[model samples]
Every structure is written in C-alpha cells, then in structure tokens.
Target: MKQLFDSVRVGRHALRNRLVMAPMTRSRAQFDGTPGDLAATYYAQRASVGLIVTEGTQPCADGQGYLTTPGIYTDAHVAGWKRVVDAVHAKGGRLFIQLMHAGRMSHPDNTPHHRAGVAPSAIAPGSGMFTAKGMQDIPVPRALSTEEVRATVADFAHAARRAIEAGADGVEIHGANAYLVQQFLAPSANVRTDEYGGSIENRARFAIEVATAIAKEIGADRTAIRLSPGMALWGIDEGEQGPALYRYLVTALDKLGLAYLHIAHQGDEALLADIRARWTGTLMVNRAGRAREQVGADVASGVADLESYGAMVLANPDFVERIKTDAPMNEPRREGFFGGTAQFYTDYPTLG
Candidate 1:
C-alpha cells in the first residue's frame, strides 16, 4: 500500500504523489468575481498535495450562483488567477482550475448584474439559495435556447483557454453536485422535450459538448471532468435512469481521452468498479465525508489513480505530511467554511 504514495502519471503530468486537494467552495473571492489576494496564499500553503483543484469558478457572469465566487471570463479574473497559479507553482504544486457554471441554483441578488439564472429548462429547483438577504427560494431559471446552449459550451472553452493563460496546469469541468451541468443531467430539474432532454444520450449531450469543446481548445491532456453519479443533493434527482445515464456518459467521455475523470464516490463499489473498467484513463476518487483512516484506500486498491480530500485538506494545509506521518489534523471550522478571512482559510498550523 506504500506504493499508493509513489509517483504516477496522470494525463500529461507526472504527479509526485497520489494525494489531491479537492475543489472546495470557500466563497472568499472579491464581489467583482475576481480571486482575492488571500486566495493565492491559501492555495500556496497546501502545495504539498500532488494536485490542487481550485474552488469552483464560474466560466461567465451569468454562470455564478453564489456570492463572492470567482469567474474566468474577464482579463481581471485571469490576472487574479495568475497570481494564484504562480504562487502554487512557486511552491512546486500543480494546479487545476475547476470551471463551474451554476444554473437554476442561483439568486439574482448573488450576482453583480442581478441577472436571472439559466438552465436546460425553466425549473426553479424547488430549493433556496444564499443571497445578501439570506436564503431565498430559487426562481425558475430561463431556459437556454439551443443557440445559447452552444454559446455556453463556447464559454467553457474560452475559460479553459483563459485558465491556461493564467498558468494553471489544467482545467476540470465541474459536472458534479447540483450545478448547471448536473441540472441538465438530472431528470427532476430538466423536463425539456428538446434534443437536450428525453433520453440519456440527450441529457448527457451538454456535458459531452462542454468537455469536448474544452478538450479541443486545450489538448485533451489538459482537460478533466468531475462527476457525481447517484447524487441526490439539493433537490437533484436523476431518477431510475441515473446509473445508466452515468454509464453512457462515462463511456462517451472516455472516448475523448480527457486528462482525468474525478468521481465523487457514491457507495456501490461494484458500480464504481464498473466505471473504472469502462474508463481507460486516470481516475481520481473523492469519498465525501470519509474518515481519515480511509484516506488512501482507493489508490491503494487501484480503484483510483489518485485520492482526493476536501475538509481535511482545508483544515490541514500540510495534509500530505499529516498522512505520511500520521499527525493529528485540525478540525475544520464550520462557521468559516463559507465566507471568512484567513483564519479558517489559511491559518491552519503544520506540524513542527
């Protein structure tokens, strides 16, 4: 199992270890959607991890669904992210920017222009989102026209280019959680009878297109995607077709030869193994809320090429060291998980 800590090739990059810092939403960017100064320091501090995936950053203004989330569309956003990438690189860390587009999970109050949200269909998600006025029921989002859908995919391609220009090692398309891409994949949220809905192939089309566009813009070697199969979070229900939908989606994406496929492990060991059998490239698995003792099991068992950690990495900047030496980890502060200063973001102590 010690081999799990050894270096391995993932896509075009050779990581020094199999530990990865998972993308986490800290809500610490500027109100203008630019990454703040502390963001660089925060990421740089955790450079010990083999790879660091930055918090979910919107690809465009309308793509933002939460307050203070970063964007990659503007020159300013690129410049801000450049600082972060430079810092991480300086510390000998490889970084990937997770390009996320929040769909109907948005409130106009959270965005700068206060624009209404957009999704595959005009659905409200039947949930509440955090806004300046506190949590409010999400409004029914505007359904993107077929042309707009293509435009959105182009936006992802543009963001991937911008992320490369900003010095990131790669870009991870956020197709997980209850975000824009997942909304389209979930039957409960997407009721469109158009070409983008109805069948598993149709529902998976948007994600496939976005991934293909980004992979084309950058090489497939510099593109990655994250998926959460069987996820039922925030009113997202992919229904009985969830498993089959993911199987088709994974198989289709496998043909693209993306940098890696990051999966948020959702039980079902056999299904996870099935996905691994189908996908031929690097795989990174994140077992959400997993115990510290179980950290490297996925990599050790060959279920994944790398293992990703969220809160543990958040509270323990020296997570790699902690794992190696079996050191105690600082408990993550729930209050500072979202909007906060450097206290929970970067002030965690490393073992002396």
Candidate 2:
C-alpha cells in the first residue's frame, strides 16, 4: 500500500513525502509583477511539505489579471522567483510555479497596462473582482484572434523556459478555476468559430498546444496541469457535456507523459474514477474541506498518488510535523489571505 508519507518520483526531482502545499494566491507581489520581498520567507517557512506549488503566476503582461500577482516572463520576475526557489530548495523543498492566465476574470484597474482582459470570446464572467479603486465589475474581454491564440501558447512555453532558468523544479499550468485554459474548455466562455473552438477537441486544442509547447520547451517530466471539471464559478458552466469533455481532454493530455495531473474535484466520483483509470502518470487530488482524518485516505485508497492541502498548510507552517504528531492546527485567518504584510503571512507558530 502507498502511504501518504512515502517518498516518490514526481518528475525530474524525487520528493521526500506525499504531502503537497497546494498553490494559494497570497497577492503579495510588487507592482511590476515581481514577487514580494517576504515571498522567499513565506514559502521557505512552509518548505516542510513534499511539494509547494506557488500561486497563480501570470506568464506575460496581458496575462496579468489580479493586482500584485507575480509573473514569470521578465528578468526582474525571474530574479524574484530565483530567490524564492533558492529559499525553498535550501530547506529541502521542491517547488513548481503555477502559470495562470486569468482570462475574463480580470479588470482594467487591476493590471499594469490598464487594458481590457483577453479571452476566447467577448464575454464577461458576470462577476466583480477587488481592485485598487475597490470592487469593480469585470468588463467583457477582447476576444483573441486565432493567430493570437497560437502566440499565447508560445507565451506559456517562454514562461516555462524562464521558470527553469530561475531554478524551479517545474511549472504547473493553471487550467482550473475558470482561468484562460479552463475558459477555453468551457463552451459558455468560449464561442470561437476558428480551429480553436466549437467541438470538444477544438476547445481542448489550446490546452494541448500550450502543454505540448511547454513540454517541448522544458522536459515533459517537468510540466503539469490542474483541472476543475464541472466547476461552475464566475459564470463558468461546463454543462452536461462536462464529463465527456474531461474524458476526451484527459485522454489527450495523458499521451504527453507529463509529470502529473492535479484535480480540484467537485463531487463527481464516477468521473474521478474514470480519470484515475485513464491517467497513467502521477495523480494529485485536492479535496476542498477535507477533514484531518481524511488526510491520507486518497493515497491509501489508491484514488490519488498524492494529497494536497491549501489552508491547512497555509495556516500551519509546520503542517507535516503537526500531522505526524497529530497536533492541533492553527486556524487560517481570512483577513490576511490576500496582499498583506508578514503578520499572517509568516507569523504562524509551529510546534516546538
């Protein structure tokens, strides 16, 4: 039986355990999309986990959606991430920077360029986001031209190269949570008539192309993606075709021999079973609101090769140690979850 604490080969790196610190956006980067000064300390503090997936990092200027989210495409961004990578590595932790394009889930006031966000279609997410000015409605994004779509794929590949240059163990494509990649998979968000949209295969083309490009640029063993099938957030509705689309999408993505596939599941046991059966590589599952007793259940039951925790690890810097001792966990403070100083970022006490 595979225990949660067992060592495993995830990609080019061998992890110390199976506990993963799932990527959580702390919105603490500088105005230039560079990671904040405390980022190194914050991540290094939680380096006890087997893997630490960084927050949703934009790949390019246009990819920026939220205020102060880090990017991976520039020299300063690379330098910022290098410090973070080194901090995590020095503590014996592996890290994968998550490349996220927020798509229509953005506002002009939040980005540096102050331009409308880009997406597969000219549609709004029917929601608002926090900005410098305050809460504002997300505007209808400028639809990407078919040619622009291909260029965007190149942008992901370039970012992957930059991440590797920064000494990261790998990069995870943020294809979940109604981001650009998931926006393309969602028919309601994507209404393109070009080769990039309409049917399931066409809608999945951008993700496959982006993954293929990144896998080619970096090694496939260093590339991974996260998906949230049937996730109905911010006006994203995959509809009844959700399961079918994922079946086809996973089958195609599995052929790439990527490092692993992370799924932010949403109560679809049948589909989850199907995904587990079809996926041949490592699988990581993040169950929202999972109790302490269920920490190692996924791995023990063979549902997932690795189990990820977000809030638990976020609030408890020594999450792995606490789990081992069955010690009480610190409650996550909601107020300091985003764009804050080190009060809640790094002040979490650990077992002595």
Each model's lDDT: 0.92, 0.95
**Number of the top-ranking candidate, with TM-score as the measure:** 2
Give lDDT tens digits, candidate 1, residues 302-321: 89999999999999999899
Please give the RMSD to the true structure for each candidate, in Å: 1.0, 0.6
Model 1 residue pairs with clashes = none
| lDDT of the structure predicted as candidate 1 | 0.92
Q: Count the backbone clashes (under 3 Å) in each candidate.
A: 0, 0
**RMSD from true fold, candidate 2:** 0.6
lDDT of 2 by residue, 1-352 (tens): 9997899899788999999999999999999999999999999999989999999999988898888999999999999999999999999999999999998888898888999999999999999999988899999999999999999999999999999999999999999999999999999999999998899999999999999999999999999999998899998988788899999999999999999999999999999999999999999999999999899999999999999999999999999999999999999999999988998899999998
Task: For residue 79, give model 1's deviation from the true position in Å.
Answer: 0.6
For model 2, the stretches where C-alpha displacement exceeds 4 angstroms are none
Model 1 lDDT, residue 131, Cα: 81
Question: Which 10 consecutive positions of candidate 2 have the poorest summed lDDT?
Answer: 4-13
